[model samples]
Target: MNRSRKIVLFIAISIDGYIARPDGDISWLDDVQGEGDNGYSEFIQSVDTVVMGKKTYDDVLKLTNNQYPYEGKTSYIFTRKETSTNLNLVFTNENPAAFAEKLKSEEGSDIWLVGGADLLDSFMKEKLVDEYIITTAPIILGDGIPLFKANNPEIKLNQKSTRQYGEFVQYHYVHA
Candidate 1:
C-alpha cells in the first residue's frame, strides 16, 4: 500500500522564530554564512510541487524581481483575490487543507509547503504536514512575522537529524 505524498515545511526562521519581516522582507536571510546552498538545492530536487500562501507567492516574485523561482515545479497559490495562472503556477481560491488532501493522494513527488504564517497554521490545524525541515539562522529579528502563529495544534516531532552550516542550524523532524 502506498501512503500519501508528504507535505514538508522547509523554511528558514530567525532565532526569534520569525520567517520574514512585517513588510515581507527577508533580506536578513542573505546574511547567513552557510556552506553551499544550505541544502536548498538538494531539498528542492526532492519535491515536485510547492504549496504556498498568496503573500509568500508575492514575496517570492518581488524578491526575485519577477524572475519567478521554482521553475521546474508546479505551485499552488491560495488566495481570495482573483489571480491568473502562468507557466507552472496555478492560482486557486480552494480551501487549503481540503485541496491539499486531494493533492496528497495524487501520484507525485513530495510537496513543499512554502509558507507565510496563515497557510502553515491551516496545515498544522488539519495535521496535514508530515515533515518539517527548519533551518534556524543565527540572527534574531526581535519582531516580525512568526513561523508559527498561535492556536496551531501542538505536535510531537521525532527528531530526525540536526546539522550545522556555519552559524546556521538545520533541523529535520517528522510528526510523531
Candidate 2:
C-alpha cells in the first residue's frame, strides 16, 4: 500500500492532444475554462495545493486577471531562476520527485502538478505523477505549445474515466 500523498495533474487539452499553441498561447482554453458540465469545478476545489512551472505561472497570471486560483491552497513553483516577488509562495529549484517527497512529508493536502509542458515532462521522466485528469477541447490549435513537449519521455496510462462537457472531453488517466 502506498502511503504517499498523491500528486494529481489536471490539464485541458485539445481534441488533437495539445495543451496550448506553439507559443504558449492558451486563448482557446479561456473560452471553455471551468465550463465542464462535469465535476471539474469540484475537482479544482478539492485540491489542497498546486505546483507549476515558472512559465506556466507567468502564462496563468496573464490569463486570470493576475489572481491565482490556488491562492488559498499551498502553491509551489519550480524555477531555476530566482524571483524576488514570490517571497511568500513556495518555490524550489530541485528535482520534481524529490521536492514532491518533501511536500508529502509535511502536513498538508493533495498536490496538483499544473504545467506548461517542460515541467510536466520532468515529472513524467521521474515517474512521480500519480493521476492525470485532462479536459479535451473540441477545436484544434493546428500549432502551439503541445500538451507534452518533444523532450518528454514516453509513458503509458490506464484510463480511469471519461466525461463529455460542452465541446470538451475529459480524460482521467492513472498509472498503468
Candidate 3:
C-alpha cells in the first residue's frame, strides 16, 4: 500500500447523494454558486498533489475545455490506458494508496482525490482516505451517481463540522 499519511476526498453532491447527473454532467451546479466559507477553495490551495480517475479527468477536460485551474500543482491521473496530453500532467504508475504514499515520501503536500465513482470507490475500499468534505446543495437529483456505489464498503464517519451558507450546507466528515 502507498504510505500517504495525509489524504482527503472532497466533493459536492446533491441532497439525494448524487455527485453528478446521470449523464456525468455538473451543469446544475453552475447555477447554484455554492458560495460562502465552504473552505474548499482555500483547502485545495493548501494541497500540492491532486489525484483523479481517467473518466473524471475526461469530464473535467470537457467541462473546462482543457483549461485546468490548478496550475503548477502535481496531478496524478489513474488509468489503465495510456494517455497523452500537451500540458504537464503526471500519470500515476502506482495504485491510489501507493501513489499517495510516494507523494508523501517526496514531502508532497496534502493530497486531495477529486474524482468520479470508480477512483473514490477504490480509495474507500483501501481505507486510505482520512477525511471527506462534502457540500450538499439544496436541490435533489433522484437518479445519478450515488456518493458510494453499492460495491463500496460501509464507512462510518464522525461528523467534524457543518456550516450553512444560504441554501448550501457543507459537512466535514472523518473516519470514526
Candidate 3 regions off by >4 Å? 1-5, 36-38, 83-88
TM-score of every prediction relative to native? 0.95, 0.86, 0.87
Q: Estimate, for each residue in 55-89, the C-alpha lDDT of model 1 and write its tens digit.
A: 88888888899988998899999898986798899
Error of 1 at 104 (Å): 0.8
How far out, in Å, is residue 61 in model 2?
Answer: 1.4
Candidate number that wins on lDDT, 2 or 3: 3
Query: Against the correct fold, how does model 3 do in TM-score?
Result: 0.87
Q: Would you list the clashing residue pairs of candidate 1?
A: none
Number of clashing residue pairs, candidate 1: 0
Evaluate residue 112 in candidate 3 and report its C-alpha lDDT on the 0 to 100 scale. 82
lDDT of 1: 0.90
Ranking by lDDT: 1, 3, 2
Residue-wise C-alpha lDDT for candidate 2, range 37-123, written one tens digit per residue: 456667877677788998888888888899875667777888898734363477678877788778787765568888868888888
Q: In order, what lDDT does every prediction score? A: 0.90, 0.78, 0.79
Candidate 1: where is the Cα deviation over 4 Å? 1-3
